[model samples]
Target: MALDKHSDTFSLQRRNQNGSTAPLTNWGFRNETDPLTDVLLGSPAHLFHRATSSLSRKHLREAPCNIQVAQAQHAELVSTYKHFNVNVHMLEPEPELTMQVYSRDSSVMTPYGAFITAMSQWWRRGENYAAIRAYEKLGIPIYDMVTAGTFEGGDFNVIEEGCVLIGCGDARTNEPGARQVAGWFEAEGWEVRLAFIDEYYVHIDLMVVPIAEKLTAVCLACTEPGIVEWLEAKGHEIIDVPFPQTMALGCNLMSLGNDKVIAPTSSTYLIDQLRARGFEVAAVETAEISKTGGGIHCMAQALRRGD
Candidate 1:
């Protein structure tokens, strides 16, 4: 249904309370790789390096992020999106929300509407509210808010049109949160699978992400064998990314569909593989900014993917 943008009673909950919610006509997507037309990104103007995760803490302790360079890199990422003819929307910058640059952590755009996620970290919780306001401004109704427990958008991975793979790392996304989300989708007749991962990995997107329909990128060393088997059973072609590169967010990429992808320059392995497959790859340097804890996929929220 089209949203009445001027209405004061603009519904915030677009999802059905009992399931069978109709997909939004103007916004949201059925899957990750579907010719992305609109995307949501957060501003890095106020980004700051923080001990958000084990990887981030390690980077902070070893070599602090150069904020200026990170900001510059983010600009390049935005430019890359523009080059692909994707409409980019930015969330208003808030100084206190230093890690806001990772837009995928706050909300997930689903077929029904936007799912406002509950952040795990105390400092990041405010991002949920920020995300709500941003969606309101964009005329996108919310599906629902994660209330059972803390859940981040990175854990909500849509494997296909009516299927999703949720991740529970206990740190960023807990079992309760994962179960709550899984139940919602299950009731909606979606094939939902929960992947319990180690906290060190932070989120499942780091090790497993969809590149295109029936094609996925995975780090076999870190992902559970069952998950790998599950993908294979569904006829998904897995491109294994080495453990070392996976840790550097090599598996984390945004597929623009129609054989196009936006990847991190650090992910040389994945980029090379995609290029070899005749996919147009736009490699942007994100190593400096990633020290704050996220890759290309984590930094962008797909607003509208299929037509």
Candidate 2:
């Protein structure tokens, strides 16, 4: 069950005239589609709002306390995103996910395109539909969906050009989902790795992220041991995400290609660590945005890359 070595993928999100989310794939256009390099990563419109959990009823009475800070953090995030040369895309807030939306977590970006996911968390299911609509508008082809397993975009990280990693735990993306991803990539002649961890590390990108070609930012404290060894085997130089900064999302760095990245304010150690490792790092204030267990890498999904 292997695909040809040279096949690619397509995305399913679409766009209206205003660059907003368009739920219809009616256009059916494929050629001349914009690449991920042309798209900019964007932040979710609301604050303290989470789009991927079953905590729908839990936030009714208890509200988020850092709304103001979250807004400021989002604005700073927007500014930071521009420095990366991204064309930001936004999703209109829907109450189905309790208004806490991590738009980037809605789907996984692949070499071919974006693959829609079946969220194991009930509150996050609607996010898939929202993302699908956006991809459809963007004219990205759809690789497929997580038919047998529950998958989330946050659990997926394209560690390298030919290697992909899938993390399963906390009911985000499960075992079946990881296997499915492996199967798909293997079919395409790509290496796939699965890291099954606790709910605390829900997404692989939360702890480990690629800053450049072979460099990664990791929090050894929570990062699984075997994966660490495997990375070393693959020739990856790991920059440990400081425990204190990791808690504040220092590990959540986003690669703007090359050796450049965007990190949050609280992770000073990460800033110094990345800088020492030869990365051009830009630090932003994200105290408000991190409350939902996501950061720079989590907020934006790279739709396409020059592979």
lDDT of 2 by residue, 1-307 (tens): 7433222323332211122222222221121112225432443454445533322223323554366777677778777766677666666566555433465577766555567878776766777787777776675666667788788777877777667777888467788878876777676666788898777566787788877766778899999999999989989888887676776667886777656677887888878877877877788887665665667777777654442
Q: How displaced is residue 199 in candidate 2, in Å?
A: 1.5
User: Lowest lDDT 10-mer window, candidate 2?
Assistant: 26-35
Colliding residue pairs in candidate 1: none
Runs off by more than 4 Å, candidate 2: 1-36, 39-43, 48-64, 98-101
* Top model number, TM-score: 1
lDDT of 2 at 122: 71
TM-score of every model versus the real structure:
0.96, 0.81
Clashes of each: 0, 27
lDDT of 2 at 164: 76
- Model 1 lDDT-worst window of ten: 3-12
